[model samples]
Target: MNFIKSLDDKVWMTAKARYNASARLNKKHQALTFTISFLSVAQIVLTFCMLVDICFGFPEKVLMFIAMTTSVMILVIANQSALGSLLIESEKLHRFGIKFQSLYEEISLYIKLDKANKSVEEGFQQRYSQLLREADINHLKIDEELVKAERKSFELNPICALWIKFKNLVAIYLSSFLYLAIPLGLLWGASWLK
Candidate 1:
């Protein structure tokens, strides 16, 4: 009974860790996607502005030149940032997190049922093997040093982490409004207002 309890505790902890890692990775993936989209849109908008200036004799040639150059640089950086399996790995981590959660729940159920007719070792081995296969399929290569550094930097302070996340959300929304929504609204000002 004690051994089963210990095993269950270990599995639960592992599952919780997986879920936390998944959330972190997914957040990174989302941030990268947003950054990529923002850079792409900025590039298009700046190009359009440049063309308009070329045709209409609108001033601000120097300013537009600077903006275009900056946009190009941003686009390049964003593209480079995406030159990885981040999205695929994030999705796989999410699936693995769910799997861990499910396994945890099953173990909890087994424990509550007094372990009758339930082979904890067998169940754990099966689920753990599945997780291994998933890791292989997803090519999940975790850098322990980086992970440890990140955890030490971010996860140590819950309040700060929450605040940072809130800030990121606000930045994403504000940038979206500024870069996409406002321009779109201006483009269809009359129709949209009506």
Candidate 2:
């Protein structure tokens, strides 16, 4: 028998996939929240040092002006990044992940009980949709892709898998790091000249 022929099976499958995706998304958000936050703090500290240098007449006039401007830009960008991915949003995503987990379990139970009727399926589907609406924001596409990957593990050729992993690495980790690293490197190099 095609397992998914039953409505409850379909609902349970979708809910389980969604829950897994949400969990991955939550992890991504938490990582972004922590990484961006740490980088912002480091930027602020670097900016403070630049200000100190300005006060002490440690840099040439032109360099001092550049440093001051750079400091302001750093502060502005840090504020923007913080606003873009607030800790509260990450916490909200975490809560949503739990909610998805609950929904998944509920559907599984319904399936186990052989209560796979149209009404039950529709109700659970509506609940899923409502939960998504309440979330107010959806998981990133990468999260969905990762969940699909888990379900279809080793199906892709080695080259394809490597490409996907590389893309994920760059998107999830390297991009954020480079955003801060480039500016920090410039500031650090500027410091060395002082």
User: What TM-score, computed on C-alpha atoms, does each candidate reach?
Assistant: 0.51, 0.60
Off by over 4 Å in 2: 1-66, 152-154, 184-194
Give the root-mean-square deviation of each candidate in angstroms. Answer: 9.6, 5.3
Instruction: Give a tens-digit lDDT track for model 1, residues 8-101.
Output: 6655555555554555556665665675577567657656777666523334554355455546545554565452565666566667667766
**Number of the top candidate by TM-score?**
2
Candidate number achieving the greatest lDDT relative to the actual structure: 2
lDDT of 2 at 85: 62
Pairs of residues clashing in candidate 1: none
lDDT per residue for candidate 2 within 148-176, as digits (tens), equals: 45556438666666666565566555545
How does candidate 1 fare on TM-score?
A: 0.51
